[model samples]
Target: MKPINLAAYFLCGSNRESFCDRFPSYFLRIFRSKECPPNEEYLLCGSACPFNCSNPRGPVLCTDDICGEGCYCKSGYLRNDNGTCVTMDQCVGKDEVCGPNEEFLSCGSVCPLTCKQPEPLVCGLACGMGCFCKAGYVRDTANDKCVTPDQCPTEQCLNQNEVYDLCNGNCEPSCDDPEPICTKICKGGCVCAPGLLRNSAGECVSVDKCGNYTDGALSQYMNVINKILHL
Candidate 1:
């Protein structure tokens, strides 16, 4: 005879014990004071058996056709307050949504698509232990949408780096450049002056190819110098 399933019998409760007592002696096993009973009718009830035990005699699949309604709904399924369909929204991270292939659950809400947060109502990029939203995004009303923190460009992006040195009205060392400026020195003890390049022997040569140092065009080279300087 098949071994009596103790767990199944326990779930079946007194119905299983009474059924065994009324039927075959092979359905019952006594070990010390413990009496194992045969399978009682497996009553697929509530959401726990949402597909109605998968038995042909089971009820059809419907959100409202939950077994054991108000009592149990499988592992993840929950009963609605009105006791109609299982509450799909209660799944949250548990089921996310009823999977397309499974008949156990129905659709509720699309899970929130944010990176790491499991609950659908949360917002913004999921952060590390100590990290906060950097700049461009902010915590929205639902705590969702790491939205543009401030109006674009009007207030400028927040400097995420804690320490900042200001150059004029902007951050120093320019975000794009590494160096500040290049200083020039002439080899022949001659002051080649700014706005000019030196030759091999240290003769100050106009960047424009040897014009007088006092030429009005020197101011133009000075402008170029300022353009290349980062800070």
Candidate 2:
């Protein structure tokens, strides 16, 4: 028989001895008491079992989705109260509008397109982690929304490192000698800066964790990459 998932018991109040005993005896002996991250960081209802709180069934690809998926706003949506989707004007007092194939997310200043912060990222709130793309989306710097990458933007696209440095949404046609590789480019798109990869959530992430859609982004590598790229 397939092993029964014991993770459900790990939720805050569900950790009674009766629930703990549900596990096989052999597995129970080595069991440590349940540990919980801060409630705001992970609420059982919103954090686990099939992503997207606003639309539980979610997109077509979410049919077999797993637990604790990276919760993000879908394309054409911006975060509103409690991290759910809302129209552009509803995203606080800011007047940011997401164009087609895009959504408002706090992609910092690096991403060409961005949204206004709903609230400062102080600890006690629901969206303290900030809004990002849905599980299968990627942020497009040019248009500023989550997008399904159909194909590479160009044949002469810049390497990961080069893209990270420049690409402020203005792809110039030509320039002086040694004029950044994207000189003859127009309408620059995001192509994962150095050491970054387009993750399933449609955000640029480190290459190491890109292959695993459910895996969380590693923080140390993020800090290092940010320092190097000045993002």
45-151 in candidate 2: lDDT tens per residue? 23332223333223445433354423334434444557555544455544233334433443322222222221123334233123455544555545546555432
Q: What tens digits encode model 1's per-residue C-alpha lDDT throughout 98-132?
A: 22222232232232222222223533553211112
Computed on alpha carbons, the lDDT of every model, listed in order, comes to 0.33, 0.38
Instruction: Give candidate 1 misplaced runs (Cα > 4 Å).
Output: 1-71, 84-231
Error at 161, model 1, angstroms: 13
Cα-lDDT of candidate 1: 0.33
TM-score of candidate 2 against the unseen true structure: 0.18
